[model samples]
Target chain A: MSNLFFVDKISTENIQSIENEEAHHAIKVLRLSVGELVYVSDGHGKWISGPISEISKKSLAIRIENTGETHAEKPELVVVQAFTKSDRNKEMLELVTVSGADRIIPWSSQRSISKWQSDSREKWMITVKEACKQSKRFRVPIVNNQMSTNEILNEVKTGFAIVFHESAKEKFSEISLPANLDRIYLIVGPEGGITEEELQLFSTINATVVRLGAPILRSAHAGFAAMSALQTKIGRW
Target chain B: MSNLFFVDKISTENIQSIENEEAHHAIKVLRLSVGELVYVSDGHGKWISGPISEISKKSLAIRIENTGETHAEKPELVVVQAFTKSDRNKEMLELVTVSGADRIIPWSSQRSISKWQSDSREKWMITVKEACKQSKRFRVPIVNNQMSTNEILNEVKTGFAIVFHESAKEKFSEISLPANLDRIYLIVGPEGGITEEELQLFSTINATVVRLGAPILRSAHAGFAAMSALQTKIGRW
Candidate 1:
């Protein structure tokens, strides 16, 4: 992969000027001269590539040789992650972003030890965007919504939903998706296990309760495990 | 699950005395009184659980109630993980431990940006041990000795080995395994990627080269992703 930088909005002009912090890092820190190849993305879907036309201390001009669109993965994978505070919070975001979760929902569970501040969502979005750029990912995963336990339970009723719990009798491997599915949701609980009321609510709705395996996994790590297992089982890996 | 503690050695005696930091945490910090239930493990495979007979600031005595043995998972899973420095190193260790990797080998890849110190392996072992406890896992995952590139390549000839590379033609989900295989090895490279010489060395030994889905993954997160994929494909998840 080539060196990829982020741009706010991309246009279809023959040449694009990068004047953001990314431009400063590329031109000043990286010290790329004209004619060196690099790539830039808006972190939406489109990316442009070609040699640099002009380089300066503040910005660089990219002579757009070709442009292409990177499509998101099919079936629209979503992870309803319970909020975990401190470093584990950032860890959950980084892992889900790099592991192919398309939409991440920060769910507030009753048993969650960590509470989400008002600015927490914005901080989470920043981390997700940077993670996408670091991984050279085009369709950046969205940390777009925060949900309550009841709201998430109601949300998963539309598509294939699997909750990862240690007490669940069924294994995650037993889940099989049907054809023409629109979405697949993996619900992760907090460090402290999901509360009895939350489990009852999900069970009342008849959501498929699944366990990763025999051993218990921490809440932050469970999301990635479930996502990977779902992707592999559905022939998406 | 009861509150589980750790002990270096266990026996068939009627009572076991808890000493050291775990005892301090349980007795002083957590305030466990007599007749309260708790569990203790050898950090190997054996766990004994019972009520507390004596509790003090220094130690606690547990009267042995019932002994149970937890066995290791079959068709042993091994991950050849390249050493990633700092916090990412612990992330790799935690993910693999909870995801059910039987043995983790810290490899010295040619393109590895991070170098392992003598104490690095010891710290890794501590993380693995803690991960096992946090996950309520019975048999702790092994953090074995380091391996050279050539040594690992030579060792994988007998078992099914797959190298995760970005440029590989085969997808990880596409591989088929034999029914009675003894082991499955997944080799993960570093952030700079595997060198040409290292790739050539593995190719010469006929190790199946494979790639995860389309997007690139960080060096730290790749091991868990590959292990989850393998576990799901092999019906172990």
Candidate 2:
């Protein structure tokens, strides 16, 4: 796939305009011009690929040839990641985004060592967007604000909920996911582990506790492993 | 589990010595002394949890009480990663080790961006060892010497192999693993992707070509996703 630029004009008459950073990169850095093919995305699954018809200082207009929309795949994967150290949390966010999670939730578990800043949600969204462009995904994942354990329990009780614990009796693959589940919620605890109260809360709410196997993973890496295993088991991968 | 220190002698009379950096940490940093409890591992899978019997400037000897060996898990996973840029190649090595691959092979593919130096194997092992300790895995993954594509094919002909390709028609979840399989090889290409020649080689060897779904992962991140998915499929997750 070519470097895709996001634009607002997807169904424009004959020409679509590319502006902002996308335009600057094409004209100044890549030196793209008329007659050169530039892939464009509306960031809502709509995509267009055609030759550039007009190039000015601010924008490059592309002549539309063909356009298509990519449907989101299933079963959808949502990762609820605990707040860890700053850099490690970012690493986990980037890793899961690249691994193709449908949505990401920043969770503040009892044992979490880090606290979310006032701008933490916005910063996390930026990280998700950067990962989306890097992985060339046309659709950006929905990034949620920092959530308390009670808040997450309130939301996930309606879906298939999984809490990854080292002491869980059943392995992750052994759990039988019930049907009518369009999405799976993967709960990753902090490095120190979820407190007894937190585990009790989820257990009381009927969330299945599972283990990812022998090795203990950091808070950030667990989401990648859980999402991968769940996606494969749900037959989407 | 207490903080585990590796010892060269696990089957000693009653005293097991924890020397070198492990000793320094026990005595100096952790301020551990005799009569204190400490976990010890031989790293060949033998582990003992007992009290510290002797403490010196360079070593902390432990008294063996409970002794047991950890059995290696089934369906051993192996990742053959194509060499990429230095930092990314190291990142891939660290990722797969933490994901529980039993062995790793550095592949010098036709499109490899980085050449494996003569001492690269030793450096790669260091990365693997670091990841092992970080993940708290008792079993250390075997780091193999760098191999050309031809060499990998020669060695992998006996095992079930799956080459991850974006153009593959079947998803990784679609393949049925044969029973009694001792090992599985996951071939991951460089960022530029597998050349036609390389894909043809594995295809000719009857390796199943599979996709990990829609998003394109970096060469460093693909192995973790592939290993996690395959381990789940084989009932080891």
Candidate 3:
């Protein structure tokens, strides 16, 4: 496969215009000239196959040849992670994107150290988009606004829900995954872990409490590990 | 659990002397004083419960109150990873230790960007030790000197072996683990992935070729996922 670049929008006609930023990247950073073959994804599941027609300092034009469908519309696995400190939260977002999580909900648990502000939601979206581009993912995962534990639990009632805790007895491997399961909601606590009331709420709601392992993994690492394992178990990965 | 530190050498007596770098860490970094409680490990499965008895600029003395029996011996899990660039290789080592692998062996594959040098072996050992400490592991995973792919295959004669490849037909979860299997060897290729010859060699030797999922993961991330799955499959975690 050749290098794929993501563009915000593109047309199917012979002459297609590239976004200003993408044009600068192709002409200045990648140094592509006229008639060079390149691929661009519109983040809407369409892969535009074309060649560079005009390379200007501000914008580049491409002649489209064919279009291909490159994505699926399946309901995605969303992780509702309790907010940690800045460093760990950033790492958690990176890991979740790389591990192919569909959405991330910054949650405020009883033990959360950091609180999410409405102003910072856009910044978090930018970070997640960058990670998606780096990982070559066609569809960027959604970043939801911060929610309280009760709000998240309410959302979990609509899908397959699982919570990761240290004291859980059921190994993840032994859990029976539903065959027609489409959307999965994973809840991870902060570094200090979930409070007893939170666990009780999950238990009362019949959420599957699973254990990854005995050696306690950091919050960021545990998110990735659990996502990878769940994907493998569900035959998605 | 409280913070635990590993010392290189410790006498089997009730009185223990901390010197050199550890002493500096206890005295300056953590700011522990006399009669304070601390946990120390010898990095050989032995953990000591002790309290500081004396303090000085260069030395801190501890009086051991109790010695617990060693935790269960680590199940042998060896990681054969192809050499990556410096920063990525370091992250790979950190994840390997955090995932509870017992040993790491660097491999030089056809697509490897980094070449192993004799002088860098010591630095790799230090990285592993630091990762072990940061992950709260009592024993540091052994870092073997660099070896060729052929050499590793020759040495791994009888134990269960698995290779992670994107095109493999079998999923890792489909493999039936041995009842008494104590050792497992996982081989992961570099970012460019393994060559056809290496795959052929593994196939000829009946090594299980497994795929993690449909989505392609970076090489460094593959080993950690495989180890996590294996640990769960064997009921070791």
Q: Backbone clashes per model, in order?
A: 0, 0, 2
Candidates' lDDT values, in order? Answer: 0.84, 0.84, 0.78
**Candidate order (lDDT):** 2, 1, 3
lDDT of 3 by residue, A18-102 (tens): 7677677777888887888776777666767778888777887778886777566455699988888877766678778777888
lDDT of 1 by residue, B46-120 (tens): 989899999776889999998898886668899998776566888888888888898898899887767778887
- Native contact fraction of candidate 1? 0.68
Query: lDDT score, residue B17, model 1?
Result: 79
Which portions of model 3 show Cα errors greater than 4 Å? A8-17, A34-37, A48-54, A61-75, A117-119, B8-17, B35-37, B50-54, B61-75
Candidate 1 CAPRI-style tier: medium
Top DockQ hit: 2
lDDT of 1 by residue, A112-180 (tens): 777778898899998988778778778888886778887887788877777888888777787777887
Every candidate's DockQ is 0.71, 0.81, 0.42
Interface RMSD of each: 1.1, 0.9, 2.3
Give the DockQ of candidate 1. Answer: 0.71
Worst 10 residues of 3 chain A by lDDT: A1-10
Q: Which stretches of candidate 2 lie over 4 Å from their true place?
A: A25-36, B25-38, B51-53
